[model samples]
Target: MGDHAPDGEPPPPEVEPAGRVITTDGLTKDYGAVLALDSLDIVVGEGVTGLVGANGAGKSTLIKILLGLLAPTRGRATVLGLDIAQHGEAIRRQVGYMPEHECLPPDVSASDFVNHLAQMSGLPRAAARERTADVLRHVGLAEERYRPMGGYSTGMKQRAKLAQALVHDPRLVFLDEPTNGLDPAARDDMLELVQRIGHDFGIAVLVTSHLLGELERVSDHVVILDSGRLLRSSATTEFLDSTGTLLIEVVGETGTQDRMGQALAAAGLPCWPQGHLIAVDTTRATTDRDVHDVIRDTACDLGVGLARLQADHRRIEDVFREGGDHVLPTS
Candidate 1:
């Protein structure tokens, strides 16, 4: 049973929640100067942490090194309080990994596959059988668990992989691109299952994805990587807070937006056009009330309707842009 501790199944009365599920010290990886990970130091606590980046951003490299599938050129790391270099096997026993690509054998049923892996993880035969059933149901594959892997849809294949990852009752899980190759509805379903694994099942999750916005709905904290380096690491709430840029749209005649932009610039508040809205830079301004009054008076003087006025917030993609790393918006 994946007794989501949050669901009235709190940790044992004798045990306190542990801290720092993962930590890295100067973690660096160099494939003959490519430098996949560059002096990266980070600590991951409980709950869902989103690792976001585009292709070649060292996300996969970092996960592989942490899982002991690959070694770093220099630096040390730990997972679940076990040193990766010395206790790689022990770490693997406590952590689960759902790889990004297809690895399921076509002939075997998902039930057989999960049960076999559960046994491989040291579960007793009967316990393995029981756990396999529990996890498959947990991942929404209970009804389809008997089907051959080759006959499953892309969404079902993803769920089966997730079921195997959870069959062993791991303390943490690494979900690499779990929503990949899914349509909109299937993608939403997969993301919800991932959130349940972390939130409902009480499993620490490190989910990596190129789709930025998807994580905002589920992740507790977000860590951004770009070009093999850390861009930003903070709570999801902080990233969604007001960015101090006011998005205002003035409606009137044809040249109203441009005229408002010019008027705001003349008033010493730097402004620019963003499609249909004018982005007013408020960093140099005194206060929100003052800025609001100024904009309101400017619109009144210009005889235009204040269509929209609200503070802007940074998106996951904005983190990269702010860090001077230009990339296409994946959301």
Candidate 2:
């Protein structure tokens, strides 16, 4: 069970009395020679959960099946507890979708497009326009909402796409690579907006992305897929163990790192230089006293101020590296 909540906080108990916003049992999809989804089983509830994998890892296949856009070759799935195979029209009414590829019409203004979508979702014309405007402003696209999307930057285009998805006030949203092609600052802004959508608005979000590191920062639970199979699924924090390694940052000349490495080794510590920093790899059995002694004497002998020494946070990439799955080779 993937029980970890976002940012180390406990998730609220399921609001739906029946529980499980989404579930799939033995869900399978095939493309001739390739099995896109191999009898995959999954469960998702309220709040934000990340679906992550490299391209062609069946992330897209799973989303398409869940959205009822593609029928599974075998097995079955339910969205909001309604069988997608039989209740696809009903499911689409409550589920908002932001597809991965670009689908916006270049000639239309975002305000017009979003308004049109809102109305299509069963809102009255007046209410659709109002909600469209609200959603555009919420996604930081107020200034450009009226402008034709063909001239808009990639970031602006993305915001326009997002505004359309939220215009319908969907109970659950499927966001596909919401940060795709964004610069660092824009990507951060998009992530914060995603978190806000799930937490502040109380909407269930199932977002998919290829960037493992960014997903780790925002998702409460992370599900990893490999070669169309479930490689691992668990709470994000659990994926990162509290390894007792201390990442020490010392400021000095070029040889300072080398000197510190030499000094720590000579002092009977199995320390090594890592890029511009030094890392003390403590074993599971190593005590706090062992780290303290290593840090204290090593800094004093090298005459380098401690600068900073804190427990190293294991990154999501580290887990994938250890899992021994290879990435698809590019042609």
Candidate 3:
């Protein structure tokens, strides 16, 4: 379900859930004079929603409160229609969490740790072992499932953590910085695993990370937080729309970059040099249909071999900087 708030404001109290999987009402938390979370209200749909913010943006505090690890100083919350206050245990039973920090025992193997977690979630001994094997393989830890976690690389250790989270076959999972400290390839693999956990397994995912751009490729929706308040929340497509700014790519040395910019300017296209790229301001590029043609003509006129040309899509970070107002307002 999606938010029904007019002008992007927080949905009203009387607004019924349109298949909303999670909701918070006037949630607040304070650490003495420090307000960790304001009167925050939010609605989460039934797919992967990325929680993005810098450190101390109340991301961790919000997670703790939702998980029932921290009680709100004011207001209330519900997950899967289960009140966090009254159904903490029941909520936890169906929700799996992969913490940002390392929590595995050095002496234990991935198989051992996952099996134990599965049993803790109330799976029987034999079933826990069987489920553990499936989860480990799903996270791509087949060969090293029996090896001690202490010897595992950061990537391997992360996979083990993910395995344990999936051992119980949760309906929803929270992954905190699952790609932290991994190389590019490993990060991509982890992202693919996360995508499958949400789409293929039909499980809801609420993943958090300090890096905003990283979630763009995988998340179905994104929630931006700042200073313990809701900054923005919207479908990924809203932020990734490329209907604005002109994207231009030219071939040649750095000198070609300047030549292209000068050529576009001579033709009255409001353009600027953005590192190796040239960004044309489409706010006044004749018309939307003519923008691409203008870029192509300018590039050819400069004798600059064009490599790529298209509308510039806003990155995740761009949306955050502009607040949700640029795409959708905060009601």
Writing each residue's lDDT as its tens digit, candidate 1 over 1-331 gives 2222223332322212376799899999999969899999988989999998888899989999999999999999888877777666767877899998899999999999999999888888999999999988888899988989999999999999888888888999999989989999988888898888888989999999987788877899988887888877889988788888999988888998999999888877888999999998899764455888899989999888998999998876676567574563566
TM-score of 2: 0.80
List where candidate 1 sits over 4 angstroms from the true fold.
Answer: 1-17, 244-312
Tally clashing residue pairs in candidate 2. Answer: 0
User: Which model, 1 or 2, shows the larger lDDT?
Assistant: 1
Ordered by TM-score, highest first, the candidates read 2, 3, 1
For candidate 3, write residues 177-242 as lDDT tens digits. Answer: 898899989988998889899899988998887777778788999988777888888899998887
TM value for model 1: 0.75
Best by TM-score: 2
TM-score on alpha carbons, each prediction: 0.75, 0.80, 0.78
Q: What is the lDDT for 276 in model 1? A: 93
- Give the per-residue Cα lDDT of candidate 1 at 117: 95
User: How many clashes show up in model 3?
Assistant: 4
Model 1: per-residue Cα lDDT at residue 291: 88
For residue 318, give model 1's deviation from the true position in Å: 3.2
User: What is the clash count of model 1?
Assistant: 0
